[model samples]
Target: MKTFSAKAEEVEHDWYVVDAEGKALGRLASEIAFRLRGKHKPEYTPHVDTGDYIVVVNAEKIGVTGNKEKDKMYHRHTGYIGSLKSVPLGKLRETHPERIIETAVKGMLPKNTLGRNMYKKMKVFVGPEHTHQAQQPKTLDI
Candidate 1:
C-alpha cells in the first residue's frame, strides 16, 4: 500500500456554513478547525493546506456554558511596555461577536504558517447574511 501525501494542487476544497446559535463555543470551534484542516478527508496531508472555507453565521448567539461568559478572558499585547489588554467574554461578544468565534477557532488550529492559511479560509458573520452564497455552501450542523 502506498502512503498518501497529498499535494496542494490535488486538494479539493469546499464551502460550508455553520449556524452558531445556541452551540457550545469550544465544541463548535474544534469541529470547524478540523474541517478547516481537512482532517475529515481521506487524502488529508499534514503539511498542506487541505481545508475548506467555513462561513459561520449567527455568531452573536453562540453560547458558553457555566460562568464562562463572565470569567473567560481574552488578552492581547501591543509589543509595548505594559500594553496588555484583557476583556471578558461577555463584553467581547457584545462588541465583536465575530471576533469571539474567530479567536476560538484560531486557537484550535495549529500554531504555524499552515495554520494561518487555514485561518484565512474561515469567515464569521454576526447575523444570518453572508456574501458567499454564490459558492453554494452546504449547511453544516455543529
Candidate 2:
C-alpha cells in the first residue's frame, strides 16, 4: 500500500470554542495546541496544517498552580538599548488576559511559518462572547 499523505486541499478544518473559565492555564493551552496542530486526528500530517480553528473565551478566568500566578513573568523588549520590560503573570491576567492563553498556545506550536499560520487560527477573547457565530463552532471543555 502506498503511504498516505494528506493534501492541502483535502484538509477539512472545523471551528471549536474552548471556555477558559477556571481552567488551569498550562493544561488548557496544551489541549488547544494539540487540536490546533491536528495531533488529535488520525490523519494528521506533520508538514501540513491539518488543524482546526480555536476560539478561546473568558481567558481572564484561567488559573495557575502554586506560585506561578506571582512568580511567573512575561518578558518583552523594544528594538532599543535597555528597552526590556517584564510583567508578572497576575498583572498580565488582569490587564491583558487574552495573552495568557495566546502566549501559552504559541509556545506549544512549532516556531516557524507553519506555526504562525496555525497560531493565526486561534481566536482569543477576554469575555464570554465572540463574533464567530457565523461559523457555528462547537464548544469544547478543556
Candidate 3:
C-alpha cells in the first residue's frame, strides 16, 4: 500500500472557536498550535498547509502559572544598535492581550513559510465576541 500524503486541495479546513478565559496561556497556545498545524488530523502532510481556522476569544482573562506576568519579557529590536526594547507580560496583556496568545502559538509552530501560512489561520480577540459567527465555528475545548 502506498503511504498517504495529503494534498492542499484535498484537505478540508474547519473553523473552531476556543475560549481563553481562565485557561493557562502555554497549554492553550499549544493546543491551538496543534490544530493550526493540522497535527490532530490523520491526513496531515508536512509540506502542505493542512490546518484549520481557530478563533480565540476572551484573551484578556488568560492565566499564567508563575511570575511570568512580571518576569516574562517580550523583546524587540529596531534596525539601529542599542534599539532593543522589552515589555513585561503583564503590560502586554493589558495593552494587547491577543498578542500574548499569538506569540505563544507562533513560537510553537515551525519556523518556515509553511508555518507563517498556518499562523494566518488563527484569529484572537480580547473579549467574548468575535466576527466569525458567519462561519458557525464549533466550540473547541482545550
Best candidate per TM-score, number? 3
Write the residue-wise lDDT of candidate 2 on 75-125 in tens digits.
999989999999999999889999988999999999999999999999999
Candidate 2 residue spans exceeding 4 A from truth: none
TM-score of 2: 0.97
Per-residue alpha-carbon lDDT of model 3 for 1-142, expressed as tens digits?
9999998899999999999999998899999999999999999898999999999999999999878989999999998999999999999988998999999999999999999999999999989999999999999988
What is candidate 3's CA lDDT for residue 110?
97
Q: For residues 1-142, what per-residue lDDT tens digits would candidate 1 score against the true structure? A: 9898999998989999999999999999999999999999988899999889999999999999999999999999999999999999999988998999999999999999999999999999989999998999999987
Off by over 4 Å in 3: none
**Which runs in model 1 stand beyond 4 Å of their true positions?**
none
Evaluate residue 49 in candidate 3 and report its C-alpha lDDT on the 0 to 100 scale.
92
For candidate 2, the 10 contiguous residues with the lowest summed lDDT are 1-10
TM-score of each predicted structure versus truth:
0.97, 0.97, 0.98
Please give the RMSD to the true structure for each candidate, in Å.
0.8, 0.8, 0.7
